[model samples]
Target: MMIHTEPGIIKRDGVYFCSSDSFTQDNLFYILWGAVYSLDSPYRVSRSYMDAFMLQYIVSGELNFVLRGKTFTAKANEAVLLNCREKNLYWADRQAVVKWFHFNGKNTLPLLNYIYERNGGTGLFKKNYTKKIEPYIDSILNEIHKKDSNVFSISHNIYSILCELSAPPAVLESPAEKTIREALSFIQSNYSKSISVNDIAAHVSLSTYYFTRLFSKYMHLSPHTYLLSTRLEAAKKILIYTFEDIETISLRTGFQSSSHFIRAFKKANNITPNNFRKVFYQKSID
Candidate 1:
């Protein structure tokens, strides 16, 4: 992790480091490093990348984050879930006290992406809206301050926090939530076929125009994009788990042709299907 901080500010931080072996374990999440810090206004940091996710909870005051040319703010009682594997900037918008951790493990990156998408493409989780995990974070801080590491307990707590993040807010009442849920189920069930906005709207008994707007409002993405994503995920699994050729895989994943599949895959992932398989298919490599 390369972090450049503005000079001439008081900073107090508590941090923890886990063993290198913890990073590669299956079904386990481990903190790589973390610290609780207090910073003054105008204090800032910039990093090209850190190979982990950073979860920071603002205990007091506010922090502003900049990622991929967009900025968001987290005031006291809010949280920041930053996928730090890219260039980013953050600064104390006011005097601030924050508890934070950096962690990575199985499914962490994908989970971070999920949260980011649902968060309206920002790191801030909205003030007072996600305070349920504050206690879990405090437990992590207690672990950080300990002499011996309880890796399993920390992993369990981290997963618990993830579960909280994954839960739909209790405020999402029925009918509307029911509609989105039904739509999601349908897409998941039939993404491997030629389904369209009209088909989905008809399935939910909604007008095409209304369904499109409702889906975007609830899902933060158009139904078409969501369907594309589902197909891409299916294709990725096939690529990783099977040695099938691109044309067959594309057809199985609902793409019109290998050419279209290749184009879409490359556009989304910046890597061709063949290369993605070669790079990520450990079974093949083995």
Candidate 2:
């Protein structure tokens, strides 16, 4: 089954960069395109404290890029990938236009590395991989252009690129940490059920007593409290998006009853479900 998903976005050839026009696309995938331009000299911008990763495929002119205290120049057709939460400075020189994407959500790091490795870790222009990578970049543009583009495809493509860029495993190590991560992943996947520490411990093949200690050591919360937090988080999502009654939301989020759910929600958020919804919705509309 195809999972419909929203694409994270950056615009290429958008109003910010356009001399006389704008470009837009409508894919289930989110591809936002925008540009910055100047005629007399180079236009430069500096970004700090961002949430996602950015990769630019320069379409025209020259770009001076700074990453991790190092600077480099990228001419037309060359690309650069910035890892998440990194601060970088870049400027364009002499009539420059760039096609860029700001991508996030799951596997972004791997994708960035994959693109870098494929381009020989030096310059995107020297590696003859644009023909190979263009399809993935174009996928973003095409999805934005389409009336019904599947965002899942774009997400999958990004994940695929990440997988390619990641280094292969060296040796098996840190079994305890791996076990804990697996246990937490299981909890995240099964939070909507009546779950317990024993269930999760068994899934990870550990004694409940030992799992409890180890989990608290690593995660700073018992499995039971963790499950409660996860359920409360799910309920918060429902409360924000749906007008479903309290009982329905409680059941859907795996609480035994509305009263139980309400207590948990109030404890976590310091507000009743209805009040939380009303205040948030009111603020959103305003």
Candidate 3:
């Protein structure tokens, strides 16, 4: 495929190209190239005819596309896949970044057709469903860079991702489910803030009582417990990777105080923050 109209990206973006033998081409789904690109708005692709299926997961900003006489937009956390051989057009309508790839295989086109038909002739996957498959895509992206690419495993993962895309609920999402999804996304973004259950419920426009019931029903954890778990996880990473003081780490991770942080961490991990750090350091030295 030709990059027919790119002024250039705003930042340095990296990509890897993969080559496969005849057996792989005949048997496995294989990546042609993949990258995490921070693209400029003026970037566009109208040229076609290189035969492959293009899949992109938007990380930020927006992308607009015209495929099979239909137009669509992919926002952050959404995904789009289409046949590259079609008379299609797609561009970054705003400054956008994505984890994307062009892949080819014996059965790729058939799988794409199934996925499009399943979604009523569209390839856009909503944020909720795409979340389920990002880890598999991450694996494929990492494997494509290895000295000896695991073609079989990559093929399985690509097939798994496609299979997931091909299966959305009969009805896209229920109102309750959508509410919970929005709440989860909000928590991911705001977990570093000193936010409470009330704050979270307010953000989602629900009463605290109802929201707590719904959150527990869906996630099997109370909002308070989940929030504390998020903070503790962040503190653990800090303890292992940085020399930041425990108090600073506690405050930054949204804990009310260092003592509270220590108590919670020990309850969760059976070890204090300082002891955890020392153990990690000792392991590295050993």
Candidate 4:
């Protein structure tokens, strides 16, 4: 989508970057545009139609967003993802600093659908995940400042930011459920490292036997199976989205060896990793 601000709006101080045509043509996931604005006076923007999805985070003050004729207020540490095709208006309730990213690609719609389903069809919500999102925003801004920013790096950071947003809301977990959830979070964050079921159990301060039973009951899979599945899932995403070779992919996904990765991948997917990658690229090309 073209990037243009409405005329006759109050002036604000901001830094922004728009993706180049070459970058947009080659990347499946990309930020079409982004901006960080610090308003000295009141600011407002109205749009009848925006061609890409937008994620806006409030940094210091509050924003009043009107979408579908409903008004919602987002304050510091909160965010909203607007379906840009809809009519919307957002204005600062007072002087505020805000950061926003406009993103689109093949994966965007499906990811948005998943988020909407989990969020009860609402576009505004509190940021319940950890506080690492701000650093990611800084990283994106730094990358954009480079004379030749790597598209992959910026895109990957954007994906990380979205993943943080799309995480399920914080729930009050029972003691057992909390322990299991901690273990699962560890597995997800460290799957690429050389970690074992014993290590996972130890991190959660549980005996191997007890941990195995609890995990199975809660997750419907043994801890070992869960770790393996996590690794395999990471491998699959890398294979489909990146050009890393089989050996590199194996190492990155925590497999002991390329041959072992191949065997496990074939057993799980009913096709070799190479074949899976080929099929994915072929579909993208078609």
- Indicate which candidate wins on TM-score: 3
Question: For candidate 1, lDDT tens digit of each residue in 194-274?
Answer: 788799999999999999999999999999999999999999999988899999998998888899999999999999999
lDDT of each: 0.82, 0.65, 0.86, 0.80
What is the alpha-carbon lDDT of model 1 when measured against the actual structure?
0.82
Runs of candidate 3 with Cα error greater than 4 angstroms are 1-3, 170-286
TM-score of every candidate: 0.56, 0.42, 0.59, 0.54
Model 3 score (lDDT): 0.86
RMSD of each: 16.6, 18.4, 14.9, 15.1
Of 2 and 4, the candidate ahead on lDDT is: 4
Off by over 4 Å in 4: 1-13, 22-26, 173-286
Please, what are the lDDT tens digits per residue for candidate 4 over residues 1-286?
Answer: 3334443234443446656566464565676667777753356687888778887878877888887567888888877888788888887657677777777776777888787777766677786642657777777776766668777777787788778778777787799998998999999998898999999999999999999999999999899999999999999999999999999999999999999999999999899999999999999999
In angstroms, how far off is 275's CA in candidate 4? 55
Candidate that beats the other on lDDT, 1 or 3, i.e. the better one: 3
Model 3, position 126, has a per-residue lDDT of 88
Give per-candidate clash totals. 0, 15, 0, 0
lDDT of 2 at 3: 26
Give the TM-score (vs. native) of candidate 4: 0.54
